[model samples]
Target: MPDSLLVVDDEPAIRHAIVRAFAELTVIEADTAEAGLAAVRERYPDLVLVDNRLPDGEGIELIARIRAIDPDLPVVLLTGHGSTDLAVDALKHGAVDYIEKPFKIERLRTTVSHLLDKQKLGRQVARLSGKASGRSHLVAQAPAMKRVLGLIRRVAAVPSTTVLIQGESGSGKELVAKAIHERSARAEQPFIAINCAALSEHLLEAELFGYEKGAFTGADSKGKAGLFEAANGGTMFLDEVGEMPLHLQTKLLRVLQERRFRRVGGLTDIEVDVRVVAATNRDLRAEVVAGRFRQDLYFRLRVVPVPVPPLRERPEDILAIADHLLKRLAPELGRPGLAFSDAARQAMVAYAWPGNVRELANAVERAVIGAEGDAIRPDDLVLDEILLEQRPAPAQVSAAVQAPIAASSAPASAPALPPGTLLIPPGERHLARIEAMVIKAALADAGGQKSKAADLLGINRTTLYNKLKDIGLEQAESAAG
Candidate 1:
């Protein structure tokens, strides 16, 4: 839907001009503060433009009332007698921008467009953070994840406690942070997240603690509020925080210690009440020992340490998470009612997910897009293919494939190599023995065709030849040829 705008002005000409200017939007107009507040509640416009002089009251007062109704709704105050004091008061009461009378149409349009775009983006961020859909409701059927959830509950009860989440990449560290924020007393406030490793040191610094206007070359002329300032009275999630530069780490330490920070090139400290949740895949203690991280900051952030276990450690969650992800993804991708076959489920549980939840999400998404039938098969998941692509050791391959092979309906005493099939006997655990058995089975299944045997083994002919040489079958194959 196109964005909606609400204009509260006593003058009919001003309202008409705004309506004409924003013809594309569903413009709502009111002649008095009472009508404007009523329109705001009923129309639910994305932005509000109010004139200072209204029939019943001043628009500056309306700004606060409007904020009380919707704190995120952007308001622009319009006035003929514009003064520094009026502008300050409007801003203090929650007006996003102030405009003097006889403002250029283009300038008004640009300002309104910018504010609407910013508000829309903020809503999208909120949705992605799981605010819209009970994002705090995480899947914690596994005891490990349940413990992490318990930690989140305990820390969330304390509004200002700093939390440091340590985990491997893709283990849902940010999700845990969001859970804490959503369950806390500040759930209604903003939750801002930034990746410390994703930006350069200077840019990261400027982003976390905003810079003053013209603080440095290429700075925003109007200056900008950084994530720290934006997340006041809420939560600030610092992801990959171990990668933060050492110099900036000192400033961050100060913020944690004093709850105050100075904008870049600014003299005065700006005090803020923000709960910080920092996450890292790397071990910050190791980084500190190596002089890459601040020792003081490390200790401060570690006050409420929450370690997120890797997906492999919580084996029971594999199928559960896959099912959860499938339910969420199917309808989104226009492929609903898709499910994993029993074999697929066994394969998912057996394979080790080194990339953790992120990889599983990707795998499920790929399956949802590519599955041709109602149920996803093991081939669709391609668990064995992933292992083969990794070029794992023979023993590693055996461990990964053993369970799925056992789950197959093949007879226990079946011939080792039925045509186009290979089977491993029970109680076979030796790596070299299994390697030899698999190769010989492949050769037999291929009718002693070495090239076809290599294809059956999911390896190139050269690799197969080397394996044959290792098992002392090269001479026999050459003689047979």
Candidate 2:
């Protein structure tokens, strides 16, 4: 969609001029301060051009009010009575730029375009860093995760279904919700999300279902559209839904059941086609039993229930997720070509990640910064010592397992050792030392062919190369070849 620009000036000529200049944008006009504020709420413009003086109030004050609604919305002040003090005050009041009367249209266009581009860039950065929307691909290799993906595909086929996602914190509930939306028929529409516990009761009401003009104290005089209206024909993800107030829960239930809602303090009901995806770390069944949550709402939201397995339960995915995280974090942190030591990989697999994927991401970021060499060691991971100590010891290998280790020392021309063979010396519990010995044996068995050695070790060539570098066998491999 083309960006929208709001022109708030009493003079018809000035507004018309700007609209003509920016013919590409959807220009909205407001003749007075009151009308301008209302247009801001309803139209959701990308940029604003307000005359210094309005019929009802000063443009300087309106800038502050517009900022209260959206701190990031770019506002440019146009003044016929140009003064240095007026320009400084306008900026202090939150106007991004102040232009004197009879300004060049090209200059105005340039400023507006720059601000919009900057905002777009900022949003893109936030999305890539996983701070804004959950639109990225999910890394799910474990069988439990595959089951969750299966559920998502089934639910996505029914775009209007209300979904309730239950999972521990940081288990990627929002990501799953986004996946459903992206795969659904309404993928082209907006996918908006809000944390139910972040706002107060009244604010949350106004935010979800927009209020009409003069609805309540401190309310936008020109009533605003709520997230439900903005997210029409798409998905609305309500995070921490279990913490929503009871009164709001009743209203939400109505919206879910009827697909219609009246703005807070508004008489007219607005119908929407938004799919609501509600998620919570808390068990809503318990909350319903305790009378803290509405049973009817709980039933309404759970039309499709998706349970995301925690990181600890999906042990098979730990290393895969870590590698995924590293691929993103490596160059970002200026630590490219980094690899985890065998000990660090073992420790990460053994550690029960209480905080789940979010915690693991943080640990990887920290390790990237803390690692002194190309290899990330156990200390670089900085896992909980107490938890590591409490973990079970490695199981003893049988004679059959020992046979492969013994055969791995054979000459290059000898029969290839069985796939997935690793030589762990008797009574050897040191993970790094055992890993080194296994890599050496694999190299010996393959006659220093890294590719064949990687196949025998059941890993990719890049991973085998990293292992070789970590174990200081790179020089030996070069010499043997």
Candidate 3:
């Protein structure tokens, strides 16, 4: 759908002109700030062409409200020569761009398009960052992840569908739930999280479907609302849905099937409009097949399951995550952001992370606390044991970052190549190895057709032929034949 725009102008002629110029958009006409605010609150627009002067108030006053409603919404101001100062004032209030009166219509249209695209991109960034409005969430950067982010953006526009987030422990599924909630129509409403694994059957049910007065010992004397009720107009993030007891799952499934629900000890059915975003670390399909989890409930909770990839899949992001955590944990640790030494950063990138982001966060925090100077060295990190475990059998730590394995360790008779079947020369020194692998794969895929392989590799046939010669794959192929 074309993004909606609210054209707020006191002059009928100006409003009509804007409406005609931006005919591609769904324009909502408002002559005053009150009208604009009402229109925005009623249906938040993608862009607002707010007049500098409104009938009841200055357009700038609406900025806080507009942002309060949806901070991502882009607001532009319309100004005359006399109101240029007022335009600046509006700009200070969060208006992205201004259109001066007697301005070129083309310029206004171009500005509008550029600003809209920018606003969309910013929204996507915020969405992918998995942050709630004004609150930072987890940052994940895996190819599998960017795909999930795209899904979040697509799914956010349609908030009614349930979303199931699946991942290994500490993979940040909860963060994704919060991102979806923050982007949905019910963003301003409360976000309630209940860990199904953390509570027993009776307690979990009472906590979710709220107990009435005297429903149980130590219950609120008057009454209390459950997370489902508390999150009436917003979201209920059920973490560890795999752990929810079967009885409770039936109740939750009923709630999902029907919007009306009953509180504990309350006969009256309380209705709520809640978006359910359930998450779990366990293999739910296995649970379903094993009869531990209800297949029907599983299907309900997993309307749109977003499985987060383990940290090991995205080795490239380790440094980025470390830097982000270091910056964030600095104030808490009473130390300003010190830099990571080459060794420290390399250790992080080299280690095969098993526990994902939570482990990484703890590792960074521990390193920060142990670190004395402004730099974190390899020793500062708590990764030696983890690294040793992931390395091949008969593993040993090599001090040389640049030296070949033969120079660092191993008997002269042993192969210089690491114990691993595939020898990946250090990325810098092993360019030839990588080239060989690339050429080998391409040639295999093309059945040794050099020209087609080169095209697939995005290089000229001559370059492919030369690379093939350099790798000595031609001699091997001929000998094998």
Whole-model lDDT values for every prediction: 0.81, 0.82, 0.74
Residue lDDT tens for model 2, 1-481: 3578999999999999999999999999999998987676545677899998899999999998787656767899999999999999999999999999899999999999998776666555764677752234567767789899888888988989999999999998988888887666666578889999999999899999999988999888899999999999889999999999999999999899899999988998999999999999996865663457888899999999999988877777778889877865665566768998877877787776888898898999889989999999989988887665444322332333223232222223324678756545567655467567767887889987989988877778999888888987887757988
Deviation of model 2 at 466, angstroms: 69
lDDT of 1 by residue, 289-393 (tens): 345778789989989999999886776677778987886566556676799988887667666677889888888888888899999987787554544233222
**Any runs in candidate 3 off by more than 4 Å, and if so which?**
1-134, 138-140, 384-481
Query: Candidate 2: lDDT of 134?
Result: 20
- List the lowest-lDDT window of 10 residues for candidate 3: 402-411
- Going through the candidates in the order shown, the clash numbers are 0, 0, 0
Off by over 4 Å in 2: 1-134, 391-481
Reference-based lDDT, residue 131, model 2: 75
CA RMSD per model (angstroms): 18.5, 22.3, 18.7
lDDT value for model 2: 0.82
How close is every model to the real structure, measured as TM-score? 0.56, 0.56, 0.59
The global Cα lDDT (0 to 1) of model 1 is 0.81
The full ranking of all candidates by TM-score, starting with the best, is: 3, 1, 2
Angstrom error at residue 322, model 1: 1.0
